[model samples]
Target: MGLFGILIVASILTYIFRDRLFSRNLETKDDKYNAARKERMEEMDRLLDKINSRGIDSLTPGEKRRLDELSGKK
Candidate 1:
């Protein structure tokens, strides 16, 4: 095949495997740490919203535990 044909094939393969190729094994520790922190913050916000809308007593046992964990009390 010509170089142009090879490039086209490679581009198609890259597009086909993009998700598997790009979704794993490339994160640095800082990236992972930031992602984890963001997740925790989002969860905490959700929990706090629930508490505000209802009351602390509305929290299930598991939710309460997760709150403590996110708050570093656990």
Candidate 2:
């Protein structure tokens, strides 16, 4: 194979095995917990912003429940 062809094949192989190659360094439980917490905080911020711009009643029932759930985690 020419250099270009070899490079293309190598790139494809890297893509095919990327997950397996990287899974060994997967996040620990604490990392996952922190990530989930951060996501919840972000969601709560978005909900709070909506409430500020619109009104608390503007939230859907699901959103209100989610906000409560996130808040209770703190």
Residue-wise C-alpha lDDT for candidate 2, range 1-74, written one tens digit per residue:
79999999999998999998767776799999999989878998999999999999999999988888878952
lDDT digits (tens) for residues 23-70 of candidate 1: 878789999999999999999999999999999999999999999999
CA displacement after TM-score superposition, residue 61 of candidate 2 (Å): 1.2
- Compared to the true structure, candidate 2 yields what TM-score? 0.61
After superposition on all C-alphas, the RMSD of every candidate to the true structure, in Å, is 5.3, 7.4
Question: What TM-score do all the candidates reach, one by one?
Answer: 0.65, 0.61
In model 1, which residue pairs have backbone atoms overlapping below 3 Å?
Answer: none
Q: What is the lDDT, from 0 to 100, of the residue 73 in candidate 2?
A: 52
Assess each prediction's global lDDT (C-alpha) against the native: 0.97, 0.90
Cα displacement (Å) at residue 38, model 2: 0.6
